[model samples]
Structures are given as C-alpha cells and as structure tokens.
Target: MALSNNNSKRATLGLGAIAVAGLVSTPLLAQDAHQLIRDNCVGCHTESGTTAAPSFSRISEQRKSPEGWLMTINRMTHLRGLELTSEDKRALVKVLADRQGLAPEETEGYRYLLEQNTNIIESGINQGLTETCGRCHSEARFALQRRSEDEWKYLVNFHMGQFPSTEFHSMSRDRPWYQIAFNETAVELGQRFPLHSKEWSNWQAAARNDLMGRWRVTGFVPGKGEFAGWMSAAKTAEGRYDVTLTGRYADGAALAGEGKATLYTGYEWRAGLTIDGVKMRQVMAANEQGTALDGRMFLAAEREIGGDMRAVRDQGKTELVAIQPAYLRAGESTELTLIGQNLAGDIDLGDGVVVEKVLSRNADRITLQARAEGAEGVRMARVGTSKQLSALTVYNTLARVEVLPTDAVTRIGGAGGNMPKVRAAYRAVGYSVGADGKPGTEDDLRLGYMPASWSIKPADEVAAHEKDDRYAGSIDASGIFTPGDAGLNPERKRSANNVGRLKVVASVADGDARVEGEGNMLVSVQDFVRRVLD
Candidate 1:
C-alpha cells in the first residue's frame, strides 16, 4: 500500500522539503525517452544498487526483448492497478523503450555510479535490512543473534508478530526465491551492524520525536466511521498526557471523547478498538494507562427538549408605585383607590379624575381614595401615615366614596351613617372595620373594635332579620324573616271558603292558609283588617 502522506509524523522527518523537491520534476517526457530513463530510472537499478534481480545495465548487456518491458508495465498498471495516470504510463513506457536497458557513456564519477541501479536488487536489500537486522533495533539486541538460516527463519516469524505491517513483509513474501536468497544475506549484514555502511539514525530519530503532542486520526478499521480530523494531546505537569478527540459519529451525531496516551518511538501506530455500542468502540493504545485507538465514536442519546427564560425572580424589587385607570365610561365617575406603602405625605387626585392619589408612609397600611357619581362628593385625596418601610411606595388616584340610596345603614366599628369613614388597618396587630366598610382610611375601624351588622328600618317598614320565634310558634306576617306567604298558616287546619262544606274540606285537605268558616283566624288577616280600619 502507498504510504500516507498526511501522516502527522511526516513533520518530524525533516524531509518535507527534500521529498517535495525530489518529486518536483515533471513526469518523464515521451520524446526524450533515453534522457528520461538516464535521469530517473538508472540511479536505483545498477549492479551496485541491486543484489538479486538483473539491473537495467544487465538488461542492456543481455539485450532483453521489448515485449518483456511492455509486459512489465502492463502488469504493474492494469493487474496491480497502480494509481499511475495514463500520461504517466505513456511517459514511463516511452522512456524505457528508448533506453532499452542501455549502459551510460558518462565518465567515471559518483553521479555516474548512482545512474546504474536496479529496482529489484535495491528493493530486496532494503527489505532484508529492515526485517533481519532491524529498522532501528539497538545494536546490542542484534549482536546476540548468531543463528543459522533455519534459526533465522524462526526468528523472523517471531519478529513478524512484533512488526508485521511494515515494508519488511512485502519484500520477504512478494518476490521470487532468488530475490529471497539475496535478502537473506542483506539481512545478515544489517543485523551484524558495522558490517554495512547504511545507517537509519535519522529515520529512527524522526520516528521518536514525531509522536508527541496533537495528531489527527487518518484511517480506521472496516465498517468504522471516517477518521479525518486532528485531535490534541498534551502532557500534564506530572508527565502524563491527556489525549482528546472531537468529531462526528457514523450516525452524524457529535462525538467528543478522550483518553490518556503516550508516544511510541517505532513504526506508525495501528489504531485498535474494543467494541462498546452501536457506532461506538474503545480506543486501543500502548500507553501506560491503556491502548489508544482512532475511529471510535462517543455518541449520546437524542433529545427534544426546550427551555423557558421568563421566570427568574428579582430579589431587589420595587413595589407597584402608581396606577391610573384607563378607559372609564364618560360621566360614569368610576373610583380607583391608591394605598401607598413606604410613601411620603398625602397625595392629590386631580379634578375630573375618578382615581385616588391617597398615600401613606406606613408600608403596612394605605389610605385609599375613591370616586363616584354623587351630586355632592369630594374628589382627589390622600390618606396615609408618614413612615417608610424600606423604599417601596404606592400611588393611587382616589375617587369620592359615596353612599347609594338603596344602601341600608350598617354600623361599622359600632357606628352607622349615610357615609361612614374608612381607613386601612394592619390586621397583624388587630382587626378593625372601616366606618363605611371601605378599607384604608380614617373611617377604618381600628384594632380592638368589631363591626356591628345592623340594618335601619322605617316605622312602617319591616325589619330584615331572621326572627327567633321558637317559643311563640308564630312569625310576624310583615317580617322579612317570615318563612312563607302571609296567607299560609299550615297548622291552623282550615278549609277553603270558596267551596261548600264538604267540597271545602277536599280543597284545603293538604294545603295551608285556607278559610273553613267566616270566623277562622289568621295573624296576617287580622293585621291587614286592623290597618285598613285604623
């Protein structure tokens, strides 16, 4: 597989600029094919470059057929399905055909030496070097390995378990037997150290330093969600790291999960996982804490909830200060009473205004004003004490308090009149009724006073009261408290006078207040007769 160019560790390699420059040349030219092959293909394919498969120099020396080269290109492109574009294929084929494995005619030099290398030999040697000795295994470890070929193969299997995914496996398995034999010798020299001049110190250093700080997950397991974003990992003061990643899940839900992680100084870490839930898996890492992983999701259940923002209370609050009644019927003279709490002196209700401006310094009680439609009634007044309870206040428009003609005189605080005084009372101290039964004014019945329920009756008028007539066994006929009509005297046992004697008994059998004879007596009847005569 092609290496991931977007790997985070690429930054640590310090080869970013060199790699860019190396690949900067335009794809090989079809017309100047020989020059293209000389400039590009020859460097990694000479006898010195290859130890197994024949180099381009050997091919030129042996004079291979053109069909062989064409077959090679077709296998690599169509069969292996490399990503090389058609233009790249054309350019490569043209160059190879023109070169025909020709030897260079350049003068002897280091550049000339590098121009005659082979892909098969170089690829085989690199693979052997990586697998047998070690990519960056400490020299101390390799020096101990003095085993034979069979022993080496066994050891190779062991190391395969340790590093199966690297380039080592490809060169070991993919090539022919001759290539494999070539790799065995290459591996021996690499493991013995000092036996080979090539060194991977820079590569090892890059791998070590690259694995710190933040990284983005670039790939994942099959059926797993896409891993395409960066995540942060920071070392704490205590030398512990906090690794956090934020991305979306397979189901498009937001995902944010974290794990503690540490750096590895070897090959790129292969992300692992432990299944947990739908679209969710635990990360696998080799940190001291646990195995770290990529491509796992942290999803929460869905919800459809809402919030209300209007109910918050205010502790430092002010009282409702003023009120002006709106849209009163014209000439109706409606009344509004204001009871000031923690207010100043009396308030003024302007003329033609039916509202009251009564005020009070006392926070507990307020003097209220009212308005009415009386021919003679005062408008605009203030009624309150001069004490303030904190800073709260009330302002009101006071209309005149008037008595109606149908209103029966009732004793308020043991007093009654057409218009009795009214006032505000603090019931916490005691109970009191207003003189007119209206609240919050001087007419208010003070503490220790009880309002007397009374009704005035004219001399000829009947009193409106429930009479206690248990002993008399009779109710006053004209009294408002009479249980029934004046003609109803149910217990008298009389008959109707309109019918004859026998018929009269039938008519008044179950009824009340019926006359049986001319002399029959009814209290109301007697009273009515007496009044007419008098």
Candidate 2:
C-alpha cells in the first residue's frame, strides 16, 4: 500500500536548503556530477513538470537511498538517453550521499523566519479581536464559543450585523476555506479573532460612578424594560463614604456597596459594576437637614457626572437622644418606666441591656422598665426599627450598711432592774420593842435594819454596832418611861397607831428601772410595796 505523503519521511522543499539535499543522494567527487545535474540535467525532467519537461528541483528534497540513487542515475544515463562516464557516475553518487544530512545554517534561518511571522499573526489578531471584544464581552463569551468551521462562520456573521466593520466581513467568507485547509491551525488562529468591535470599544470608554448608602428604586415604565433607581451616598469618615442603591437588571444581582465608607469622590470614584448597565449619583448635599443641599444627589450619566441643583430636604423627625441611668450597680436593680412620647416598641437596648421590668401595656402606649448589673457603667446604645438611633445613659453606685434587730433586751433600756429588793436591802443599826410589851432590845440581834434617823451604814459597820452592848443599849439608856392608863389598853392602841411607812427605791442601768423619794426620804421598793399592800 502507498503511504500518505504527509505521513511519509519525505522532506518538504519549503523547509529550506538544509532539508533539500536530504531528499536525494549523489556519489563522491571523482567528477563534477550533482552540480551538473542541477545546472544542466534539471532543466528538463521533473515530477510536477508539465509536458514541456521536468526539473530535479521538485524531487531534491525527496528521500532516496544510495541504491535507489544509483539505479535511477544508471537508468537516466543508459536507458533514458543521458550520457555519463564511470567517473561522473561515481562523483554523482557522492553528491547524493552528501544530501542525506542536514545543514545547520539553513535550519536556523528557517526557524527564525517562522517565529517572526507567528508573532505578527498573533499581534494583528489580538488588536482586531481579543482586545476589542473583551471591552464589552467577558472572557466567558470566547470560552463558550467552541464550534466547528461552519458554525464559527455563522457566529461571525451574526456579530457583523451589530458591528459592521470591514475586517469582520472579510473573515465571513475566507474563514471556512482556511479552516478546512489547515484545521488545527484554523481553530487556534480563529480563537484570537474578534466578533464585534464598535460595541466593545464604546463600552470601554463609557464613564461610570460607584455609589453607597440607603436607597429606594422603582421599576421602568411598561414596554420600556429599562431599569431606573435612586441612590444616596453619604460621606462617612474623612473623605470616605457609604453608598446604597436599588436597581434591577435582566441579570440577577443586587447593586450595593458595603456598610463602611471609602476615600474617593467626584472624578476619583471607583467604578460601579454589575451584569446590567448602571447609572450612579454621588450625594453632593449633606446627609443632615436644613442645609442648602440637604437631599440633593450628584448625577452620573454616560461620560460626565454632577449633582442635582434642586435640593430635597429630609423630613424632620424626633429622635430619642438619651435615656437616664445607663448602668446599674452591682447586685442592684432599678425600674425604668418608659415616659417619652412617640417611643417605638421595637427599640433595641444593646447587648447586656435586657428588658427586666415591664410596667404596663395599653393600646395608646407601653410602659417598660429594665434592670441590669452595673458592670462599671456600660453605655446603653439604642437602636430601633425606625431610623432613630439614640443613646441612653444609666449610672449607679454600690453601697452597704449594717442592720440590727429591734427586739433585743439591751435596746429596751437598763438591764431590767438588776438591783436587790427592799426585803433583801441592807439597813443601818437600830432596835425595836417586842411582843412582851417591855424594852426588849437584843444586843446580839444580827438584823438587816435601818437607823431610827433613817440613815444607812455599811454592812460591816451595822454588824459590829449591833454586837456592841454600849451601842445597842444607848437607845434604851435614854428611855424616859411614863405609866400607861390602867384600864385603857394602851399597848393595843400603840400597836394599831404604829404604821411602818417604809419608802422603797430601785435602780436600773438604763433608767427603765426607777427609784422614788417619799416626802424627804430615800426608800426601798419592797418596803413601799409592803406599805401599799397594808
């Protein structure tokens, strides 16, 4: 079977002079032979030659063994009317043998030319297609366009309808022929080509602005299908801002910046990106109220962006500035009654600020109270469902004191009447008459008594005076006696008349126990009690 020319080991002439001689062989230099074949013989016979004649140039790069070269030359010289002497044939054989190897100079030059042309092709293709197409279409567009030659031609034509350019139309017809001629090369080269140019370049230069803050958006008019929205971006910190936006696109994505602010404004803005088209505006006016540009928005359109001159001020609303008692004392609690008007129930007390006390609930209003540990006076930041964020301060101190019982005996007064009674009280030295109705003073009578003069002596003095006869008899020695009426019964009368009016005194440590003086005398409590009983 004949092998295909592409798969065969035959060298191509286009590869240059180095591969040219590797196709055919010649003998050694015994005579000028291979040179003569190129200059004189090749002027006639060639495989690709017409009926006029063929030259050896076409077959110079075709592989030939030494035996094949000799046989062909012999046939050419003898059978085909070519005349070569034996020495000429030997030289021709050597030339053909030299052609079997490669030449370093020719190979290097050929590789250099190939690389240069490849760079030109790549650069031209990128400028026209890849760069232009990427301005509008994402990398994903080219990634999904893997197709056959015919299919790719159709896709190219579709894009030409939108961006009819001279270069785009040229590919519409030639691409298919090129694809079939060199399939692999066509596919690789085709990947670098562009589908649309005008649409992509226009989108590349289009101006845009990034936005942030709270926003509200409305749908486009019916049959319009275009999206429109309102964005409010506020400067948050030093030259930074927060942007919020609400808009819709055919593609599904929410267009909004993060909660914090960024440092940029006006021309120096970051680009607002989305699958759908975007129109952004910076809030030139202050976020506060009553200022000249309180609610105005800076407009961003096509290539230029500016602020709206007509200002719209924010509606005035009351905010809860502060709540009292931001903190509670340790182990201490308080009830905070909701007393302010227009207070929303959805107000949020910050973490650690739990609702512990609720006073009452009614249709018109709600009374609420909360308790928390002091925790070193933590500030309670207030957040509500509405836009009113407020700060309520609560502060407290910790203190403690000792408590005592009310019913202790010591608290009531003087260790309740600890002093002795009159019956147990000490008395001074003295004597008295007995039942025999005679002067019966007993010298040894060791009695607890009071002196007739109502004086008191120490216990030892009274005991010693009672034992002395002189002292005991002194009261009797002064006795001046008179006889009683014979029949009158004077002893009974005297006994009945003598009433011992003893006074009693009692003392207490804290004045709850008392002592009393009768007329001009100090007294004992037992004697007084006895007299009162009598």
Name the best candidate (by TM-score): 1
**Candidate 2 global Cα RMSD:** 56.5
Per-residue lDDT for 70-147 in model 2, tens only? 544665665457776665554454455334311121122222121111111112234334433433333322332223
lDDT of 1 at 518: 12
lDDT of 1: 0.27
Q: Compose the digit string of candidate 1's lDDT tens values, residues 4-112.
A: 1111111011111000001112333433544444444454435433333333442233211122233445544444544445445445543343233211111112110
Question: Evaluated with lDDT, which candidate comes out highest?
Answer: 2
Error of 2 at 34 (Å): 99
Q: What is the C-alpha RMSD of each candidate to the true structure, in Å?
A: 45.8, 56.5
CA lDDT of every candidate? 0.27, 0.29
Query: Would you estimate the TM-scores of all the predictions?
Result: 0.19, 0.16
